[model samples]
Target: MSRRRHENFRELLSKREGFTVSQVSFQNEVLEAHNYYRDLHCAPPLQLDNKLSRSAQIFAEELASKNQFYHSNTKGVGENLYMASGSNVDSLTGKLSSNQQISSSFSYANIAGDAPVTDWYNEIEQYDFDYPGFSGATGHFTQVVWKNSKNLGVGIAYTSEGDSVYVVAQYTPPGNYQDQFPDNVFPEGQC
Candidate 1:
């Protein structure tokens, strides 16, 4: 483990969670025990604390209209292997394919799609303050991903939807948000 690299990682970790000089040094020592920071990819460090939110204009009548989806891909492992030793003959061969395996998953949410979208949206917007669950404790949020070569990412979302006002808490990552080091367990790979 290079002392310089260890020291650098220590510096970054210190900025995380307000670590004291001694704590930073101690963690660095622990990290060095396994050379955990050796394979750390410094470029585009992993994003650890990513929060997402989104909202759309739905008719008040469409109160029951709702949908949500999640997707994921697991790759990097070698191809699957099968063993064969039947009566005909005994042989060993490698099974490989150019394309990465893809598995799809889906989830469906039922929304009250029968309501008048315009009236519902306007009603929610106007009476959001008076709306019991829609105010203070509830609100709307938004999340958008721009399609650019840079893959520029920006998230603007709401957490607590409010009453007749339907006020929302600003979705901002904690100032401590930073790229993960060493493990990079939470890599934000291309979608």
Candidate 2:
């Protein structure tokens, strides 16, 4: 048994025939030992196991945005209201918001493509509200009703962490939700 063990050891050394095993070779020896030991006892390999082996360094970053546009009482007639969000979101390496103003709601649906998130003010918008009549209602506030509505929308984006990338799915809505437009005809919501 001792002779057989000696022969096995010699066989491993002979397998590297004509190769120089210098002090630097110690690193390779340790790695070889670890690989062989791990093959028998380690956990299952991960998806990125060998993919990053050749790269000197790997890095990743994640970014997100919760862009919103909201407004109230922009006009006197019908008390038009507008709200929208996340118009033309795009891929990038950092966080950002639409260049339009949250207080600017009347411009919904008017903005052209390639505009900043802020430019969302150009879009056409509408809202629903109930008003009360008052005898002393000299100022507009006397008959005004203050209210806020919740909107929801859904979108997709790519996120990264460490050396991994993930696809993120989300839902969102316009800033103000309106359903009282009896004249508004569409299969669902238009656009």
Candidate 3:
């Protein structure tokens, strides 16, 4: 490329929004968080899959660049997505109310690295082990602890403007099968 073109390209790149590729530490944080929750339900730990990670990363980038939220079209892979925006970059914490309701508190700042995974796991409060089945509200939690899901891949991207974050987690041998919930999603403390 010519010098002028090279300078112009650099300028364009600089104007682009900032995106954070999943680093080793961030990946570990997500994995550990999932395992912690999985253990509660007696599910085994999940291994990280590179191929799924790459696919998830690509989708995460797309979502961040476009500032949109949606699931990927990848067939047969279980997926979860989370997006949060604010001025406060600290961790977001929530709790179930006395009536078993989700009460959330928001602050101004960017989202913390592991907050998305925690948020996804918190859906457990809505999951019913006795009537194990798919529900939009608890799908993310079920996917995290699905015994049939042996592999996991996660991707995260921060919006170019640094005001939001998008998280994607993909699973192999996906969970939430209509007839397989009984076998895949077990009661807590039962393997």
Candidate 4:
């Protein structure tokens, strides 16, 4: 099939399968979210790196295509991945009424554009500021605000079945190294 025709067919199939394909790039949203959290931690802002973004995008697409969730083996970079399914509910006002019954079917609601970043940043709640250290639970949060991580890259993709979405973000000069956590990840408001 011609590329255009194939694209149209895929779109039609997605709709029929209860998946709304989103081509929206969450780059800006992701960047803003990262900087927002970084600022709170008194870390300098990170600039977006195109090469890293491309690499991240490729990995994200691979995860989506294979319907798998795992970290990439790419060296020399810190990575974070997020996968979520169900309706693309809005963060602020997507709450369902108590009386509302949940449905197994999916809705066409657009995916929460900033969900991945939000979820990653939310890990801060579990982070201990007084004793900074590396922990699987708070790694994502730490990478976002890692003081020495100066470059950022973000990528997002949806599963082939359209039932899930995956987000991948990479950081330069990766963070969370042993014995360096105290210096790289600082207490809130302490640069």
lDDT of 1: 0.19
- The positional error of residue 8 in candidate 3, measured at the CA in angstroms, is 10
Worst 10-residue lDDT window for candidate 3 reads 101-110
TM-score of predicted model 3? 0.76
Tens-place lDDT per residue, model 1, 1-191, is 45466445534532444433332332233223212211221222112111211111111102211111211121211011111222211121112122321111100011111111112222323322222222211111001011111111111111111011111111122111122111222112412
Candidate 1, residue 99: the lDDT equals 36
Cα deviation at 168, candidate 2, in Å, is: 14
* CA lDDT scores, all candidates in order: 0.19, 0.21, 0.71, 0.72
The TM-scores, one per candidate, come to 0.13, 0.13, 0.76, 0.76
lDDT of 3 by residue, 46-135 (tens): 988877876777788689778999899999899989886654322442321224321111111222445777788788899888888999
Clashing pairs in 4: none
**Candidate 2 segments whose C-alpha is farther than 4 A from its true place:** 1-116, 123-147, 157-191
In Å, residue 29's CA in model 2 sits off its true spot by: 50
Q: List model 4 lDDT by residue over 1-191, tens digit each.
A: 45466456645543442222233235666788888888888888898887787678778878877888999999999999988755432342144333443222222233454677778888989998888888999999999889899988776666545556677899998998888888888777876
What tens-digit string does per-residue lDDT give for candidate 2 at 104-131? 1111122221121112211212212133
Question: Model 4, poorest ten-residue lDDT window?
Answer: 101-110
